[model samples]
Target: MSLLFLAAVNVSPEAMAQGANDEVVREAQPSQSVQNVLREEHALFSDRLTIEPGISYSYSDRSNLALSGFLALDAIFLGNINVDTVESHTTTFDLSTRYGITNRLEVELMIPYVYRSSQYETIGAGASTGGLVEESVSQGDLGDISAGIYYRLLPEAEVRPDVVWNFSVRAPTGKHPYDIRTNSRIVDDGEGGFENLTVPTSLPTGNGVWGVSSGLSFLKTVDPAIIFANIGYTHNIKRSFDDIGSSEEDVPGEVNLGDSIRLGFGTAFALNERFSLSMSFTHQHAFETKVTTDGGPEQTVIGSSANAASVNFGATYGLSDTTSIVTSVGIGLTDDAPDLTLDFRIPFQI
Candidate 1:
């Protein structure tokens, strides 16, 4: 298990903060209010601009396999062993900059990196399973890359509060670092000890992820607090990594790619001008699978879908008029993640 929380560190989100007006934000310009910084503001510009470079840390707990039905079987078949099936703590950090174009239309770009360490006990399966040592997977460099654009629509309408339209993207940039596989089967429940049968015929591989995501977001002010929600679709391209296994005498690079869809909702509450908190939830479904081999025909694996759920909580505290400290935590309610996490951040407008 890693020490960092994969959920706590996202380079780019719909961008929820104090500035809900229609404007353009980038990653190069600096902000006028070094002490007054928006949690989601990132940009770099000449005149009306703001630039922020921040790092976030989080601790989390992980559990069961990400996929439920046959997909779980496939994950086990590949190299995604361990299946967690338990809770573990994690943390993360992020660095990014944003530029403000105008006040109504702004664009921001950010890149987040993470480090992690986790500890879990591997129980016994049957006479045919393998066991894992009760230890931890120390640390690593980075995670994924995410970016987004926000536009304050209905600026004049003000039907209720503030509403904005947003679009975002996520790229596969995390550590494909390898570790010893765990032996927790869906039926066993970590009872006895472990079995070698749980082990694949061969070694596992890394993750080759390339994805693009976009969604619509809304923000409404209730007193001193802002409630926001977003629903979007994440169409993940096929994975390019390979998993080589030995079916008796087959040593071929066996890897496949399939598309997936995800939906999410999040909100933030402000206590005052310098302090605020946020929460978010998201669900994912993996639909189809397509695989090709070295000396075999292309195979399309169908009739399988996996489901996942996630929750995130965070807070911001002002250090001065131009600098503030932020802390956040994340929980993988469902099997979609590895464990639970706690994260921290520091931001200031330049």
Candidate 2:
């Protein structure tokens, strides 16, 4: 891998775009999900309302300049390099919806229209300082919008016992504009740090932060080729009513991602008349970014706990008798998000 790491792996397909994270001091921000819902697949139909037209590819390499931790003594007050690495990417066009409003209740709707791209590099400590400074940047829009709701107080399909409850939201419309700064004062900070609470997650378009997610998930099923394993946890409460900045230099404190705990497990197989296969794993934890500057004084940063786990292999082809079609591919043992992903679903019954 060396066309410069294969063009950083084909620009990571998009690299989760827009300032892909790295900031701190906190004012409340952290709650972005692409369905870790116990590895997804729970709709025993009680009311029915499932509409999905999905296509997702989320890649992340997490690194956009470390300079040397805690701003590394202000990097000699800004002269040149010694940070090491940074990466990003994106690809989306999802239209998810699930509704079973009765038997334990349910509600969810997720929409993503991302086409983002990114790249950044810094490795200087030679030539007396100034040896390597990579450069790469890309853009695309119609991203940032995740809705949520789920309630299943026990019963996602046995385990010794089970549970589920949730709520999620992250809307900005996506195209950029929350604080987009960088003329080189140390560059890198496109509002992905939610302005300056240090960091939790953001990409800006218009007033962000309004995530209220609850948690509880447990399951275990292993029998005659219908195996299983699972665990989950969710917690987020960020609210920002809108304050672009310059109102004495807004801060609007309210952040929490110090890692909201989401650990998953997967295993499935029912290769029968139609066919079946599955795999799953998940993890979450990372936070401690404090940036309070309404009156100034509260600038902390040092975060690295956005771990990801995935492994899915599935297929179910049956196009008749109610119809059926499912395909999946997710690979990323740990990089927090995406190293590979491919999914498809189609179920009918009218």
Candidate 3:
């Protein structure tokens, strides 16, 4: 998950030091372009209550191959080989609300609903007797709910950038992955024997653990463009589950999900008062996960650590005085990342 920080516009040093005899320094009013960019960066601060509704879609496909026998003479002999592929689609709708308690302090809350579909395919699973076996599963449920607070440490100035610190907590309010059960389907082989294939009956909507994150963001405005950067860390609490095994036997265990570190930087260019364009790069690295079964020692899950990177492009258009449309597209740059993601949001201030 990406951590977003809040920001606010500030008066320049010159404006604050101006003498009474000199021309009056009128209060700074952000143009539509500036507003759009600030909102995309989550830097725009408002004293009035604001509500934002957003929707996002992401797609991912992964493939794996396994060989049961080794080749003879390095080329000629081969045994059973199986190929497994998984394609997943996820859609989420969320509502976020923000309120500024003071000029430098703000609070926010977000609630999300998620729907997911997945297709699993296996080829050559039952030696040479089986062709292709496929299974599909879909589920919809509530997602994790989160709340956070933001504080502006330093306001933007001619020689300084705006600095904001943020902290957030997430609750495990969605479906638990460990609680979902897997079912097996038997298919007849060429020799009249049956082969069993197991697949999950449902999908999880959340990580099933409490999460806490903290970060700092900085933003600077230079004429027609705004530059921003942020870095954050997330920690997941370990939790115990009644059944974490895939087989029919009950296996109670404790799962400790890996923590993650994320970094992002971007710049937004304002073409006009009502439209703007922005591009950014983000990367996250997750540590290895650990699990322990009842009366068993803790073990690290191999190949569980991952690095995900993506490039994102975004645009914002002003619709009315109190509303604006924000849209973004993300392209994956690594195997662990989603192939593509699209996000749309609309913010309304009361």
- Output the number of the lDDT-best candidate: 3
What lDDT does the true structure give each of the candidates? 0.48, 0.47, 0.82
Ranking of models by TM-score:
3, 1, 2
Candidate 1 C-alpha lDDT tens digits along 107-148: 666676555555554433332226443434455556677777
Please provide, for model 2 over 36-98, each residue's C-alpha lDDT reduced to its tens digit, 9 standing for 90 to 100: 112244323236565666666656675544433244465544444355454667667767676
Error of 1 at 337 (Å): 4.3
Clash pairs, candidate 3, are: none
For each candidate in turn, the TM-score is 0.60, 0.26, 0.90
Candidate 2 — which residues are off by over 4 angstroms?
1-41, 52-83, 89-93, 97-114, 125-128, 139-350
Point to the candidate with the largest TM-score. 3
In order, how many clashes per candidate? 81, 29, 0
Sorting all predicted structures by lDDT, with the top scorer first, yields 3, 1, 2
